[model samples]
Target: MRGVGIEVNEEKVGRTMEVDEKSVSGTRFCLLLSPDRMRGSLCLRLERFRPRLGSLPGRRQRVCAQRRSPRARRETSPARWRLKRMSPSPAVVVLALLLAQHPSADTLRVPLDYTSIQEAIVAADDGDTVLVWPGTYNERVDFLGKAVAVVGREGAQVTVIDGGGSGPVVTFGSAEPPGARLEGFTVMNGNYNVQLRGGGILCSAGATPVLIHNIVSDNVANYSGGGIACLGSSPFIIANTIVRNRARPFGAIGDGLGGGIACDGGAPTIVANVIEENIAGGTGLSGGGGIACYGGSHPRIDNNAIRHNVAWSTYGLAWGGGVFCTDASHPNITGNSLLENHVQSQTVEEGGAIYCFDSSSPLIRENAIRGHTSGSGGAVHTSNGSEPTLVLNNIEGNDPYGLVNDEPGVTLCAVNNWWGAVSGPYHPETNPGGDGDPVSDGVAFAPWLASAERLVFVRGWPEACRVRQGGDLRVELAVFNRMPGFQRFWFVTSVDLPGGASFGPLAGPTPLMLLPDGMMSGILGHAIPPDAPTGLWTYHASIGIPPHDTLDHAQFDFEVTAAVQRLLRSRSLDCLFPSP
Candidate 1:
């Protein structure tokens, strides 16, 4: 599109006119005289004559020199015309405002033009992309307040930024803009303040950069924040794997804060991350194995898989195996899976899945909190006037207790949670004969959820199967429904074997009742007899609710080759559970 000013001369009213693409941005229509032969004032009033901004360019909008006949103009009624007359000054001002945005942006290469990532940032201007080739850079990088992007040519698996156990792997302080992005790299081996102090990445002082698709692992910090630390800054952290980082105790406070991530007076968006196996507060006053927020920080922690993290203290008490919040922080924790986290303290500990105190009232909703083992409150503990709202969570399989509230006068609102059994939580005073996980006295866990009907569990032998003939193949199945609901669903299985042979289409009446919130999970397998046909074998399995309604279905296939050629390869597995 040509960047031209409005040149609408009354003598040449039928001639070409110019428009600014940047100025005309809304969903408004403009009467552009097109190159098509359109005559008279009727053409300006016709709906077909109007074109959307940017749809008709300057060259495409050319009016004819000839005029329309009076009879042709009379054929159109006045009701069809809705044209508004406007002065040429507004259109001219809009037409002249058109200029290409970011026309001066360039792409820079790392090691091709610059040897270091920091050097590229020093030479780069705003709106520039510094693309690094796949290699390990044994140094730290700082954005230096530039609104540029530093991306890897390959993904994080091949591109690495090792900090050489010196400082933070990446720094985004100095008041960097939000357009400054660090993406697609593995950042590790960073050590600051005897190894932490934002060991992987640090963004502070109102610096709001974008961090995405990176693997931050194996870093350490003796103070706080072994993976990433935000001090009064809010960054967008998306789809990163932050694992195995440690925040050990060193200072007089002796508190290891946030093994994976810490927000000290910041509100970062932490979403869809795999934060696992990190440790916090070893032999000190420690807590928050996966993430911690304090000093009135309120970050959004959503949809992350935080598992196998530990909050350990050899001397003092530890808290919050998966996440901890203190000092009046109000974080929004939603839709995450906190599993198998533990807290090991010398004196006492609580909240194997989550802990909040000192007026920190986080909203914990719709999360799957399972298999956490703590001193008390294996699922959650709230104390010191903290009033968290827990709703719609799958709170099951915790080791000792669930939802323990120690604050004297605060009753937590914990409704609509699903315990492991239908008999509610095993509280001593309230529910004496309850068979589910236990709960504390002040916690309200009544109206708990159980499968109203049948819960189907069907899993295939192997996700990726390569078995020879005479091998056994199968699918594990289970139906667990503690509620007194009627059985309405059954199993349906079919297998297509090799050599033009197939198994029976089996359907049966199962003992599973219909659960109110029905669940169907898993894949499938089949048996290979000694004389079985040696060709492609495919199978389909499902849980059906009779009358042709399928609750869930899955398809599986055996890696098939010729019977003779199957022995050529060793059938070696990649990370497979071959045997117990």
Candidate 2:
């Protein structure tokens, strides 16, 4: 696909891939993708043996962890990763996959080796890597189903792919694999004139490219998928900011589709993304301001923040301001925060957050659907033989009702949800004194939870290991919750030294609510006696609520050399060299 760079500029940052530190200093590091050598699943680093002659190609080396400088750590906010400071994007390990080192495949640079990005892609092979510098390219690009990787030199902030108000900015049509990626660029100014769908990007014919760490915004489509559209393709869309896109229908009134992302018979994995401020403008019928799944698609939408999107039907009806699924689509909606989304219409507005129709059965679980507004179903609605299941969700603070079912003989299996209060949702015929949000008749709300866990423990790792002789080897767990929710959690860790001595049941200083989208990172660690052991220190760290419920945990080991204030680097490279 399109993205990744092998540039040698300091201010114009390349994708800082982490390779093993063969030497401490006086070494040069660069990354490359060689499909014939790296087994099509790994990225090989090209360490320049002679740092003075970096421009000339020399012998290649594959060191695992690169040394992180203070400036690099400042550029990337979090120092959680032991490898060279990764980009601040979520799941930085999965950004641009420059797979196996091929001897023949080269790193083609935009405006350096080639004039444009499409020319580089055309002249490239399956194992090639196309590097785009930080500049606005006013042309369209297609992957051509090759295994190439294209990455922005300075990430998405400066690297732009503007379509110049023409067709889709990017297209992946020919069935690419998972390793084919498009990363680190801002895609905008895409205007699809005809009803062909996919204003910003299009993926069709079973294409499965990994689209991560990019900004897809300010695009307009005549039909569906204003930001990104998938027709019979299952792309991995992760950690991208998708905003300000629209589906206008060319001043027409009636269209039922997605504004930000639409999947037509595609089972795409959409995770860890922020989809906001997208609009579906129509009159009679419209759906999904943030996302739409129809025609038997089964997308996995997990751990995303979908807010402020609008499904507007000028004077008619609309459904699902956050997500809509129809025509037998069965999406797995898990661990997401859907807030402040709206379904706007003068007449009817159903499903302020989610809607299912015509046999669409989505598994909505572990999500916080809050602050949505609609006339009918404020949280969710089901109709026309749809049998959706809702579990472990915090459904609260919507305008009218929490759950509504329009079709007869179709009971929604909505159970074990927290409805803004310990007393559960307010139902006149069932629980009149319920202090939570309101629920309509024919919707199940029993077996509900007293309180829901506010944050999904995205992941946890040791930011640093506090080590002092005879003191404690305390591990700090930095937990990042991407959703706009709150929960108080504490920490405990157990360390097993190299000599079989046990240390800790160590606890954090105080418990605090990890609140409101990256504001607070939780703490977890172990207190090990440093003077006792010297070989290998294995630690297990965990974070949890006050009494019970371990939210997240990480197990890792750090090497112990000599005991004379020696620095120990971690050997466990799970965060660095993940399984292919």
Where model 2 places Cα greater than 4 Å from the true spot, the runs are 1-104, 459-514, 519-548, 553-580
Q: For candidate 1, lDDT tens digit of each residue in 325-417?
A: 999999999767687788988788889999998999999987777788987565798899899998877787897987788889778898878
**Predicted candidate 2 versus true structure: per-residue lDDT over 288-338, tens digit per residue:** 999999989999887677888999887877999999999999999987778
lDDT of 2 at 77: 37
The TM-score that candidate 1 achieves is 0.62
What local lDDT does model 1 show for residue 34?
Answer: 17
Q: Considering every candidate listed, which one attains the maximal TM-score? A: 2
RMSD of 1: 26.9
lDDT of 1: 0.66
**lDDT of all the models against the reference?**
0.66, 0.68
Tell me the lDDT of candidate 2: 0.68
